[model samples]
Target: MSGDDAQQHIYKTHGLLLNPIMCGVCGWQFYTLGIYNAHQWMQYGERPHAFRCHAQYL
Candidate 1:
């Protein structure tokens, strides 16, 4: 299936809402907490202060 179709299937199968958690710094929305955490780790490494926005806002 196409990427959009696969994503729709997963969301439907898991009963997930489309309202994702958005990053204040980059305006990127995360569908899951795990993915959000992973993005933070990959983007800013272990340093929380390195982020342009506050962690509490995330």
Candidate 2:
């Protein structure tokens, strides 16, 4: 596959759609639900910067 096609395939494989999801707590953008979930998992517990983020599509 070509470079662009390969990139699109990777994105699709990872559940990244056309819409962009933003983190409410940190204003970070995630292209896939898996990535968003990973971010939440990393922020869990009693860390100084711990926060719950609601994903908003933009």
Candidate 3:
């Protein structure tokens, strides 16, 4: 498989365990979706949401 496909597969496979309100890099968990999204926005500036949880790229 292509690198992109492999990465997508891994993300999909671990998506659930890595809760939407949790940080994949730091294990930080937020209380609500609002809070989580807010944090993501603050860190990632409203784009490339897929990287928010581990948004060092931003």
Candidate 4:
């Protein structure tokens, strides 16, 4: 690939920092999506969601 192609790919990548918590009491990082999914489902139910913010990612 060309240098320009590499640069564009880097710029297009999306990143997110996840801070996991139990019952919104503690802020800890959940290493993987599987862990996060398990925690959310067990704690809040099948479709658990964050209640703190109203913004939804499109």
Candidate 5:
């Protein structure tokens, strides 16, 4: 496959968070439902939503 085509295919099922240290193209971090921290992850003292960075689509 061409480079752009392959990249587009991958983007459809994957996403990368803004963590530059965690490589987005390879070895990116993925978050699950239970990995949240109540103290650190709170938005205005409440978690607005479960933020997941599913590096590998599934």
Candidate 6:
């Protein structure tokens, strides 16, 4: 994971939406579904089933 890769991954992870996504567990809001998913992947990646939510339009 180079710096660029990390940044790109983060950007992709956070899709930059005008309306952010809310965490089902923590109730924290993120810029996009990708951000929430990335958070889950980083925070709960080791756990089975973890957590997830899809973008309503995407």
TM-score for each prediction? 0.42, 0.45, 0.37, 0.34, 0.25, 0.39
TM value for model 5: 0.25
Whole-model Cα lDDT of every candidate shown, in order: 0.61, 0.59, 0.54, 0.45, 0.36, 0.56
User: Which 10 residues in a row give candidate 2 its minimum summed lDDT?
Assistant: 45-54
Count of clashes, each model:
0, 0, 0, 0, 0, 2
What lDDT score is found at residue 34 in candidate 2? 65
* Per-candidate RMSD, Å: 10.6, 11.0, 7.8, 10.3, 10.6, 11.3
Pairs with backbone N, CA or C atoms under 3 Å apart (clashes), candidate 1: none
Best by TM-score: 2
The window of 10 residues in a row where model 6 has the poorest summed lDDT is 49-58
lDDT of 1 by residue, 1-58 (tens): 9655565566668855356767766879899655766777666664333232545432
Deviation from native of the Cα of residue 7 in model 5, angstroms? 0.6
Q: Considering lDDT, where higher is better, how would the candidates rank from best to worst?
A: 1, 2, 6, 3, 4, 5
Enumerate residue pairs that collide in model 5.
none
Model 5, position 48, has a per-residue lDDT of 31
Cα lDDT tens digits, model 5, 1-58, are 8654454445445542222222223443433222322322332344434334423221
Candidate 2 lDDT score relative to the true structure: 0.59
Which model is ahead, 2 or 4, in terms of lDDT? 2
lDDT of 6: 0.56
- What is candidate 3's lDDT per residue for 1-58, written digit by digit as tens? 9655554465567543223357665567864444565676667567434433655333
